[model samples]
Target: MRSIQALPEFHVFFNDHVVNNFNTLFISMPSSKEYYATGVSGSVHNRLFPKASFDFIHTSYSLQWLSKLLKELVDKQSLAWNKGKVSYPNSAKEVVEAYKMHFGKDIEWFFNARALEIVSLEILWFFLIPSVADSHCKCVIIAVFDLLGSALMELAVQGLVDEDKVDNCNLSIPDEIASLIESNNGDFI
Candidate 1:
């Protein structure tokens, strides 16, 4: 909040969902900063402010979540169905593609919505996790979802957990910065 207040004559509007602790946010504001502040409760995927209302938008570790899961992944008959898995494994080519497509659509929607609310050439900052570098110059990360799914499956096999619960679990991976920039024609950056 202080960082935003540093910009001369800038008013900071912090957005969060209804479940957020807005009181704490308001209470924490230092009396020294003269800038005005407001809390908006809503999803960034949709417009929260009027047209050309903001000069800067900042998001951290939030854009990775897709608006919804890929339809094909949930459809049992679809080729992208991810049976027995909560997320795409490195070997699951089709699952990876499905996630990528879903991410692309989500990003496009986010930018389109933001385009209506933000002024042209206004700054947008998104802090995201980068892919892990591997020995073969490839990007890889320890599959936390795979571990979680495996644990759930083990419990189901032992009759300690419901198979249906395990079947319903799914996770989304964050897009690489390059893909995000490319998806929107590098306009948002």
Candidate 2:
């Protein structure tokens, strides 16, 4: 809503469970680009939180923007060939490859960092873009929307495209969280 500088230091912080008496700090940024500029730093995390640290990490629509995983894939595919056009099957393969080569690491690292913050018995719920719940139901409302979005962009441009699809694939982050908690059994809260 407002710039991180304009808000009180703690306004952006939230702790679902209050432990000890440490306060939740909020570091709100005005725009997504700036929000990311502020959010993505190991140094910024340390500085703004100079004497404080987190016990849990939570996020909503923000992670998608930060990674720009899908958008990057689309851009790469669109530029892969001469005449500014890519073949249908090639486009699909390029997209998949981009995801595998690029976004895969970013997603893995992001969650790994988050997993370290959660303690035993803590739950992290994510409302993701391609949400797990609707992943398989092709006829679901959002599935259609995803199809349309793909169609409007690469699918239509590439032609001979039978179905434009966005797989609502969901990942099991709880296991990662549990592993982190178990690994640090006696080290933290």
Best by lDDT: 1
Model 2: residues with Cα > 4 Å off, grouped in runs: 1-52, 66-91, 115-121, 131-189
User: Where does candidate 1 have its weakest 10-residue lDDT segment?
Assistant: 132-141
Worst 10 residues of 2 by lDDT: 166-175
Residue 183 lDDT in candidate 2: 55
Best prediction by TM-score: 1
Residue lDDT tens for model 1, 1-189: 455545577777887777899999999889886888889998777778898877787878767666766778777787787777775644256777787777777777777777777787558877654553221323334366667788889999999998776765667665455767785677753
TM-score of each: 0.69, 0.37
Off by over 4 Å in 1: 1-39, 89-91, 120-122, 132-141
